[model samples]
Target: MENAILLLKHVGYLAVLRDMESFNFSKSLLSKRFEKMIVEEEKKKEGKNEKLLADLCECFVLLNQFCISKELLSIVLPCLLKVGLDKDESEETQKEVEMAFLALSNINEYAIIDKNMYFSEMKEIIQHHQEHNNLTRLAYHSAWEFVIKRFCLDGSLEDVISNELHFAKEAIKELEELMNCVDWKRTKEEREKESQEEKVLLRWLLTLEYFLGSCLLWNEKYSELIRCVVQVYQTAKGNNEEIGSRCIYSLSMAAKNRAMKNEDLLNGGAVNAILKENQLPTMDDVNTQISLKFLISITGRLKGKKKEKMKEEHRKGLKRKMFEKMEEEGYEDVITSFHGIFVLLEGCLYPFISLNVCDYFVNV
Candidate 1:
């Protein structure tokens, strides 16, 4: 504790020297010192004989709870890299490192990327670690989380990513590679035992949604974003039955949001109708209903903007098909609610406008 206080004093002196007139020097110092404490904790755990490896695996959770100095993090993160890369490092240490990376990734607000030049450098180290099957897989997952949460979603970090730096493409390629790895299948025997891992997979899939959705905020990758979500939905469907259904629901919302921003009609309706068929009326909470309504409204918007009559006819045909698919899948309530929504739209929303007319969809 005393050393932590002294470290804070040093950071405070540096802040004053840097002329940070409005910066909260104490908080910054405390954050930095706390990071150092985490490092010490990691070192202490490393010295333990029995669970040295496990301690390393668990280090990131503790480390992630505080603000870490870029310099200190540069050192500590690399040590984990070494453990992940080195055959000699115990398995528990490698696991802890992976967990630490994941945990640190979750608190993106404090990642302080602009000051951490080491972050970019660490990506290369992690990439090398990813070459091995065991460690590489873990590193790949951690790196993707870091990229999406810290770099893609945060506006300031996104600006850094878009600055046309030489490393931007490399980092993005790494992230894309990581995202693509979700399709990797285990042996047939392992597939049956995957239930224990489903929660992990689902959480990661949700994170992928965040990662891909955030990419829409950038200019270059809208189509790729669509592809990513579609891929996730497909992969999720392949893995678990119920989660796959939920993934379709997630994909529907993401697709609707994308179409609303881009003004694309066919894609919008296709996504909406597919997800609508899977929707369960059991999710009667106001928020869920509101989200459903919003998705419908967005689809309605797309329907309004479509120019071709044939396309409109095709979309309606798709909706009817989706309803059938739902009924086949045993979603009776979903079909009923879907029909009710259509009835309300036709009656109170658009009486004179023919269902074929795009204008009829405008009021939805």
Candidate 2:
């Protein structure tokens, strides 16, 4: 069996496996055999069949990776989900679960199955893991990947806006629940102790950022969702730098989207969160650049009597911080570093220009 599989893999590498003649011949030889194996494994009440099932799932995973057919996917997905979601504690079962998820993620990536068709199943699987803590991190990750790949990443924004809001809503809700399961109060020592778990949590946060940012521009629950995004960003900013930067970028996009709609950009706690320290990092990294840009955009959009007052407070606070940094560096240093000076001036003055308050600042 191993030799035959290897020969087929060589054929696949030559592109002959997917050619109609070779594909039909190979499918005829393997398909029924795979089905029979699945049935035999299923019939076993208990035994070494778990390993057999795992090995078979992996074979299907490899096959799907090369090219998936509707027929092959229909047969494999159910078995993969079954073995993948099984709560058996043995290491072999765990391996099967991981393979199942990998195959599922791959299949979803290839658009073999309608992602929406399994949205509810994916949700149930995620919620099961969330409540029971039985699934492996890769299993959870793959489940989320399947959903996000199908619903969030694959389509054009207009297509998602028109046809897929329901999937996005469901996905966002599950993500919120998954995120809520994270223990945000873990001390640094505790986090280090559970570094693997922390890494998993970071992945969840990053995925949430992508899903929220991708769908936010079209989502009707813009305010509610962005607020959740802010919370996730705050929680992650301290745990992981990469995740923190991603959160900031997501928030920036959210702010920009709101500005495009001519809506108040500082809605929710976003304004305070962005300007929390009143000290934008020197635009040295992508995160800082995005962070600074978001601040400029939101501050520019500040309007109305109340928002105007809030805007003034933010402007004064930022300007004071920028000057304080410059003062600490001394006038000569600030003047010598043209880029540094421009960054500070840009951070402070862009909002003024954006708000059309440049005349007021010039007079001062």
Candidate 3:
């Protein structure tokens, strides 16, 4: 059994049998092969052999094509979920559940999840497990990777994803709590960002960006989600360039929304983050491009322009109101903060708008 596990681990690392076209193993043959293996494992009192299950999961996930067939999925997914979703406190089953989650994260990426079969049911089950705190650290990440990727795939899942926005709500609640735990008030520090808690937060931020990258923010009902994104960008921007850049992309997406009220962003500490990134000389070319693009995106949105159809004057009104609010709050303070951000924003946000366009910057 150990030898078999060792062999599976090595082969999985090497990624055998990845070529789908002309691979000669018919889907039928592969499905039957895996199903047979699953049956054989079942016969051995499945939960008793957690190590074996882990290796089997590794081998199957490495194969990757095991899920290309609904037949195999029907046979295999239940087995994985049974072990993965187990809440039993037995030490014996821990490895099995861990491997089950890791495999599920890898495997579900290939799942053809329509709303019909694996999609809604798996979502419900995963959320239930999350609420119960049944997943290990790795399992928690793997499970949400499964959830986030489901909607992030090709645009076909739009209909399948409910407008009720369950994922958004859950992410906001969890992230708000997580955000509170961080010491955002501290100034920037130069150090390696490898702490376990920081790494987990980084992963969560990375996942949350995918949802924000889409047109999901365009929906008026998700205004709180936009605020949530801004708050995250504000509090967490100093963590790392990657985190800050990703939040920039998400904030850009939010800015592109016609429903975006500029005041929400400005008052949400957006100015503070923008200034911090502006001052950072460590940004490589890639992060610089990202920062510039975000500056352009936010500036354009602030000026009442979007690629999509909308009332230009209405957008103008939003921007106008934003400036008016800034005036009411006092322009000296606002321009002092803008001194860091607009040096980059003025040149690139539009071809037409330049340093000459905004009279407010005359003193700036």
Q: lDDT (CA) for every model shown?
A: 0.45, 0.53, 0.55
lDDT of 1 by residue, 68-117 (tens): 45665554554544443444356755554555455444444446555354
Q: Pick the candidate with the highest lDDT.
A: 3
Q: Report the error of model 1 at residue 179, Å.
A: 12
* Cα error, candidate 2, residue 326 (Å): 19
Worst 10 residues of 2 by lDDT: 13-22
| Candidate 3 C-alpha lDDT tens digits along 1-364 | 6786567555553343121222332355654575567557756753656545546655566556434466556545665666665777576566556666656655544466554445554666556655776655546665665556666665555433434436556566666766676554544553353344445455566665555565443444355665676677666655654555666666665554444555545655554455455445454444444444555556566654555345777667766765565455454364555556555554555343433323333223
After superposition on all C-alphas, the RMSD of every candidate to the true structure, in Å, is: 12.6, 12.0, 8.6
Writing each residue's lDDT as its tens digit, candidate 2 over 1-364 gives 7676555444432231121223353356575676567567766876845556655655655453545556555656766676666778688677657656755664434454665446556666766765677766656676766666665555443344324434345435644665666676778876554344445445555555546445534545555556666676677666555555665766777665532322333444565565542243332234544655665555445422123324566756654544454355342242343333335535655333333222322222
lDDT comparison, 1 vs 3, better candidate: 3
My TM-score estimates for the predictions, one after another, are 0.48, 0.49, 0.61
Worst 10 residues of 1 by lDDT: 355-364
Better of 1 and 2 by TM-score: 2
Task: Give the higher-lDDT candidate: 1 or 2.
Answer: 2
